[model samples]
Target: MGRRPMPVGTYGKIRVESSGPKRYRARCRYRDFNGKVYDVERMGTSRTNAENNLKAAIRDWVTPVAGATVTASTRFRDVAARWLAELVRDAEREFRSWGTIDTYRNRLEGLVLPAVGDLRMNELSTPILDALCKKVRDNSSASSAKTVRAVLSGVCAYAVRHGALDANPAREITRLESKRAKNRPQKSRALTAVEVLDLLKRLDQDERAAKDDLPDLVRFFLGTGERTGEALGAHWPDFNAEARELAMSGNVIRVRGRGRIVNRGKT
Candidate 1:
């Protein structure tokens, strides 16, 4: 199938016309949301240069200044992008893993952004955040709603820090306490010492279970209480035989398009 054409005034179209043996002209047309159209025609010694000139013009028109102060008309989408950028930078600097970045990106792009990305920074308010929390809680889990609130709060705080706003409206919003979460009973299934020993004996006797390394893995969990991913990500180097210590340094995360990735320690 053919790709859809770019909107009337939005950038991204490029046409090359030869001006000389080694010279070409790249012409671009871009339209803004206000229905205004702009035409940029540039001539360069090479086709690539001409195309790059057109792209640069498009970026100048479409991309906002990084970390710029928010104004009354600044859109939430703009601020959110900046906030996420800084988050990714900090995460990478700390040797943080891709899973952390992917989680935040998913929550923002899937849940929070759709609900309020178009709102102006100045338009954000406690009522707005309260309604957003309720909407997300109704459709998603309590944990998901809490993440959305955190993302919103982070974006608002970023805006305030950049002098875009005087205060964070999210700070004034009430906690998102879902009835489902509040009414749920706490459950724990700790194994007794005898039960643990019997399970290990049984697993050791079962050839199939032993072949799958289930016995050792189960023993590791019973001994450490570490999560499955954390255990899966553990390495021999992470253990100290002399000190009798183990480093809970990373977790296994399955990214959507990219299979499994080891996330740096939660710490």
Candidate 2:
């Protein structure tokens, strides 16, 4: 019978020996995550210290999986690409919407990747993520910062699942605050009936608005109270004149690479 091999990511039978007057060395055969075994050793001033050092080294050691796309040393950009691929797969499986996938990809390419793409997975600490998000919030709008934060959280969570990280650092980032919202308080008031009629009259008088069918679209919105996308996605089949009802079953959205598409309504 052949000798049994050590399990992957584990080591066997540490041996410690004196190397010099006060120096000691510990050695073992470690099977890495890739299922390859290698002789590993670590030195210390004493026997116990040497063994502990070797154990610590074994604990901290990281190697790429045989066919995995992510590792501790893999760049953030590479991991983001893998994560994006997973998102696309999710969209195909109907677990996620194509619109959501598009939003994530746009944020990754425009903001998250540009800031941290070159960094290694192990380098993404909580402080670094916090700083990155804060910088984005200061430079861009709060909505953009929120999107960036969400994207980072997804990427780091994926890293954790792939064994590239211990925990998701983005989770520790502080909540993003909207400076615009803080500076400008929103006032809520509905338009008067006269104002609404005046607006409709202006839409009816404008040649460009008339040519673009904005008046009818605005009328549909006023009558159904549906979102612009939902109203645009409405088809003749969705409306029943006998029942005087319109089914809000789809939403119009522009998807990257696929252009405009009608998807199931948000509600």
Candidate 3:
């Protein structure tokens, strides 16, 4: 079957037209949810700039009337503060592990916000973000680069949700591959039964292990497959003597700036 035609006045019919020598004109037709259609045009010295101009124009057209209050010219740093506030609030209500929140805070404050926090939302483009991701991959580990990418994407998502931008520009950026990611060891070794028993016997004979009850804890961990934090959070009330059953109900975690707290397990 042939493809169906989009309705007239639909958003995102952007095209670039050759102007004078090496110059270009970018134009787009956009129709908002309210059925209002707008024709936008901007001139640029290069085709890339022309395309970017049209995308920016489309974003402004679809933004709600209330978006005018915040303005697309608002600095990303201000938006990042509001984004962090919302993240903290939701994390507290849902009992998310403090480590997760700390990771987000660290990636934003230490990496993403520091690099592009002062730019306006409309000023960001896929090429700009792609270069930043490449720089991060070169300067830091692959894992750190990935985390920073996630933080940047999250910030852009927040802007979209609040109508500061029409879409997340970060989504269109491609990540550079790291040598560590491609060539690192991929296998993990698990202890066999004999090794576990030997380890338990050694723990039993150690004086410090005896004081800490490490042998029993190791046995319990091997038997239940529960994480160390979850095991630490378990208590007598969570076990039933008659049924001989135990509930893996919660996890304990220590926050960086905050104290430790227990939260319900995901499973």
Q: RMSD to the native, candidate 2?
A: 7.0
lDDT tens digits by residue: candidate 1, 85-138? 898777567555677668878999998888899988877788998888878888
Across 117-176, the per-residue lDDT of candidate 3 in tens digits comes to 999888877788777888888888777778777777887888887777878998977765
* True-structure RMSD, every candidate: 13.8, 7.0, 9.2
Look at candidate 3 and give me any clashing residue pairs: none
Top-scoring candidate (lDDT): 2
Clashing pairs in 1: 9-30, 9-31, 10-31
Candidate 3 deviant stretches above 4 angstroms: 1-69, 175-195, 235-247
Off by over 4 Å in 2: 1-28, 31-59, 62-66, 180-190, 198-211, 240-245
Error of 1 at 170 (Å): 1.3
lDDT of each: 0.79, 0.86, 0.78
Give the TM-score comparing model 3 with the true structure, all chains together: 0.66
Worst 10 residues of 1 by lDDT: 57-66
State the weakest 10-residue window (summed lDDT) of model 2: 60-69
